[model samples]
Target: MSEHQPLSVDGQPQQLNQDEATQLAEELKQQIRNGVIPAGDSDSIERMVAGLGDPRGLMRLTFAESLGVVGKAAVPSLCRALSEHDSVTVRRAAAKTLTLIEDPRALPVLLKALLNDPDPVVQGSAVGAMAAVGAEAIDGLLEVLINPNSTAMQLGLASWGLAFVGARAPEALRNAATSDHAEIRCAAIAALGDQIQSLDDSEARGLVEQGLKDSDRDVRAEAATLLGKLHNPAWAAPLLEPMLNDPEGQVRKNAALSLMKLQATASRPALDVRLSQEDQTDVQAVLKLAINQLDQAG
Candidate 1:
């Protein structure tokens, strides 16, 4: 009986004042907590859907703005609209709203939307939303990564999700570093580095070697960068030749930086070989760092 103004069948305004917006937002919240967040006896969602058709787009934005203002209480209803409503804009807004609220429940559906939603805008919106959902949603995020239907294309989002969850996502990441998809491998490798400041020699050395040889220049470069963050000297040898010899200048540079990270003077000879022999100016930068490191260590 609370005033939400009234749903117009034709094209007229519901005249939603402050009291009305609050009433609508609260009822939507209760129905969601009760798990009855569908159209309900009042068919509230259908009205919102029709509001999406408003010529000015004002009413729709108002609904979205109000739901976002209501915070966690509106999560279930926003999720319901995201899933069941035809308007992708509404769904996108709902995703943004969930980000503000940081609702754990919305994480699964946002994961679904990130991977499965036909709309690209919704896909990116879901990515941002899942990121906001934070650590508790990480298990669901990893499940998406392991699923065959999930993809390397979405690996950036998966990486972000893993970072949000930190160490909790490590097991899945260790497996993904060797995934066939180049982007997934790169993302997984980069994600592991972000999650862990240092990897044991066994954990990183072989992966570093394999990744240094990755077919994609960007992947190889990222692997080299991640290896740089590892403090172990064993990675120095594996990373040495790549610093001066890799086809990509950035990869070689990162390898040089990583070798220095190991604080090894032994890297000098290999770097001198690259500087004297390699053509890229960027690679020369790496060669100079090696000489500098050698001087310091001596």
Candidate 2:
């Protein structure tokens, strides 16, 4: 049990034949339970875990077969192996096992799994583990949000997870407006939708202007809603063009409301044609608002 004792990772213990895989597994387990795992043993343990097939092995519903036999002392080595090992299976097993150990450090290390690991399964597990972290983890989570390559689901979830981490994603939101992921774009649009609705006119104007021509039509729709709610008078007319031509009903409706709120009297020519094109419940709302705005302005 020396702090630096090396494991017989080549399966050299007299108790285990090199070809008898079961014996090697048992020996590794016994060593860990006995606190014989030494510092810097990550390389050998990573190799051994890689040799054990998937942590998800043949078992369908649970990690009953592969990870069940590993012991607590193996936890640190497994965590270390996640970053050091070239093998994806090794990284997956380490990220999954951290959930069992409940290590505070595990939460931070798992963030690396989402950002860098070769395996998608491990990356998915890393996202699930975000609830477990200190205040510092908020910055790391925002970093994930800013990464365009992070999966759309990850970006969407990261936006929602911000409440748990409690950090504002100012730059992340702006960058995400141009994101290639539709879900990320949608989530970013909603995020700005709420912000614009609450913000003062000048502050909200910048957001509305930047979001106007977003590639995603849904985002443009939400952006229109924000411009109107914030009463940014300048954005009112430009938002109307999208309402007239945008295929989506919601986007059209959002633009009409913004135009109406801003008393866009000069924008009436653009609005009349778009009103004819819009027929859904969303557009009807826009029509009612437009009529009211016209009456008030006259």
Q: Using TM-score as the measure, which candidate wins?
A: 1
Segments in model 1 whose C-alpha atoms lie over 4 Å from true places: 1-16, 22-76, 83-93, 96-125, 131-158, 198-206, 213-216, 232-238, 241-243, 247-250, 260-266, 289-298
TM-score of each: 0.56, 0.42
* C-alpha positional error of residue 279 in candidate 1 after TM-score superposition, expressed in Å: 1.9
lDDT of 1 by residue, 195-221 (tens): 445434356456656777889887888
Query: How far is each candidate from the true structure, as Cα RMSD in Å?
Result: 9.1, 11.0
The alpha-carbon lDDT assigned to residue 265 of candidate 1 equals 72
Q: Tens digit of lDDT per residue, candidate 2, span 1-298?
A: 0122232223221111234444555555566667665223444444454543333353211221234344444555555656565666656666666555444455556667777776767776665555434343445566677676887666655666543332243454555555676555555555564444444324434655656667777667767776676555664576565555667777777777777777878777677776665667667667767866876796
**Each prediction's Cα lDDT score?**
0.63, 0.56
Any residue pairs clashing in model 1, and if so which?
A: none
- Assess candidate 1 and give its lDDT: 0.63
What local lDDT score does residue 112 receive in model 2, on the 0 to 100 scale? 71
lDDT of 1 at 7: 20
